[model samples]
Target: MHSQPSNEDRPWTPVKATGTALKGADAGIVIMPGDALAAYTAVAPGTARLTSSRPLCATGPGKISCQGIQEWTVTVRVTRP
Candidate 1:
């Protein structure tokens, strides 16, 4: 929950996150951010591993109130042309 990134510095990396089921689905899924690289095993529904090639996009610790949620946003040093 704690990171070393400050507002002056951007934190970016290949992110892999895991979620558990809380309701009818019994599991939650990690939706890949649009501006990052594709990670494998996105179909698992309970866990996700997101990778990035450039600093084009950052994610938020977004969450759903009723279903529960968390997200991470980071900036990368790599850039894609």
Candidate 2:
């Protein structure tokens, strides 16, 4: 999961958002909103839930602004049952 919009901030910066599956990974890992994360997973039949994460740092839109640094950051926790 990765995304680096060429123009993330602008008068008309298209709210870049999308999701894509891995190219060769064999699993149900669906990245959410721009493949920025592995937000969901299907661990087994009829059993699935959202992954967890800790907020390391976040900035953008209204949290914080810089000359050319507009983005959000976080650390996702991978769990297994």
Candidate 3:
């Protein structure tokens, strides 16, 4: 019989944003670079998945004012060609 897996056994990976930016005035939104891999890995046959721990913040005029420390996570998957 197959054994159940624990959270520690999950295949989730950690990723970070290379940059962050605020977009739009009316609909101001925070944007950041998701998961990124080497060109070789990106061109592989598998899919990449990205997941953020929390919503990014948008500040400045006409945007959501946010302060304090915030964190997020991004995940990606790559396969061999």
Candidate 4:
């Protein structure tokens, strides 16, 4: 998963990233420094839900309009041939 933080939002951080059927390999999930938010891999036939959230209010000048936080999610389904 990837997140593009807007000017009024802070960077996204991982929240719930765990599953039972699939395992995330080290080689498959590459940690790109200062680039991507997160990476995952599906090593088996199963379903996984990746979620992340960021603060709605970003630190900067001016009046802060946004409050609370925002979230992002993706469901990955892998199958065997």
User: TM-score per candidate, in order?
Assistant: 0.19, 0.22, 0.21, 0.57
Q: Comparing candidate 3 with candidate 4, which one achieves the higher lDDT?
A: 4
**Candidate order (lDDT):** 4, 3, 1, 2
Predicted candidate 3 versus true structure: per-residue lDDT over 1-81, tens digit per residue: 956433233222333323222111222443233322222134444444433332234334564544443354444444443
Q: Give the alpha carbon lDDT tens digit for every residue of 1-81 in model 1.
A: 865433223233444443321112323455344322323322323432333233222234562223222345432222221
Which residue pairs in candidate 3 have backbone atoms (N, alpha carbon, C) closer than 3 angstroms, thus clashing?
none
| TM-score of candidate 2 relative to the true fold | 0.22
Error of 3 at 7 (Å): 33
* Candidate number of the best TM-score: 4
What's model 3's lDDT at 42?
A: 44
Candidate 1, clashing residue pairs? Answer: 11-75, 21-26, 21-27, 59-73, 61-71
- lDDT tens digits, residue span 1-81, model 2: 854332222222212222221112233664343233432332323322233222222335564343443344333233432
Candidate 4 per-residue lDDT, tens place, 1-81, comes to: 956556334656743565654564454554433222454556767777777777676655673657787687777777851
Model 2: CA > 4 A from native: 1-39, 42-66
- Candidate 1's C-alpha runs over 4 A off are 1-11, 20-36, 43-81
Provide the lowest-lDDT 10-residue window in model 2: 14-23
Residue 49 displacement in candidate 4 (angstroms): 0.3
Candidate 2 local lDDT, residue 63:
42
